[model samples]
Target: MKKTQYSATRVDIISGHLTEVVDDLRLVDVADYIAFIRCELFGNIADIVNSATELTFYPDTLTFGLGGEYTLDWNTAPKVMLDLEFKNMGVNAYFRLTLGADSTEIDLHHVRFAETGRSPADNTALLAAAFENARLPQLTASENLG
Candidate 1:
């Protein structure tokens, strides 16, 4: 596997559009954090990569600005899959998530739950939850990654 880095430079904080927001740095951080959880849950990065599965979070774990305050203290803040569980709560998983392997890719069409019955607001969240935990599932085989 190869190591990947992403950024939210595409998001325009100053432009308040009707669309949703995506934080790139947070996305990368979330991916890193997911790998950590998956490694602990699965075994090694290789297992996770070989598993070739996309992870989704439970609706309950989809807790974001839903109902809480935040503390940016690294030493004191709630440690978790930070970005997934906290930062980009309103964003879709397809836009936020990626396959464990570069050769692999997510195929499901991600969209919002319109009155048209497309998908729910947290569609991606509901989409990626592999098990009970919203843990990410990949470990890059690069020298700097896994």
Candidate 2:
């Protein structure tokens, strides 16, 4: 049997008015606009693991009665498969605003492990911090965009 692989779809953020140049203005003037524009970019990855256990075989052994000596063995063991879906909802918006400009790329590399029973609000803080850290350099560089 052939194995199956899944691919994530790419999402783009539109940069409508950012391309327009205003008269008598500097790049710093649009720093907030650029930050706001780029801040809209977001992505999500949903990971899931499915497992199953089952007892399939039983054998009767030596001195004891068949029922008493019988032992059970599991045929199927627990298995986990990682399924990841990537979304790039606003990447285009950020790229359009920062591309060709002296802006630094934001780094969003982290493996957040949520607790077994945690509320969405509980994770929001961590996520917010991660995002802030990722955008800090870009926001700072926006002031010097030429």
Best by TM-score: 2
Over 4 Å off, model 2: 1-116, 138-146
lDDT of 1: 0.28
lDDT of 2 by residue, 53-135 (tens): 00110111001111101112365322211111111211111111122233222112222334435553444334333333322
- Model 2 earns a TM-score of 0.19
Clashes of each: 6, 0
Candidate 1, 27-67: lDDT as tens digits? 33434545555455423332332222223323343322111
Whole-model Cα lDDT per candidate?
A: 0.28, 0.21
lDDT of 1 at 92: 38
Error of 2 at 73 (Å): 58
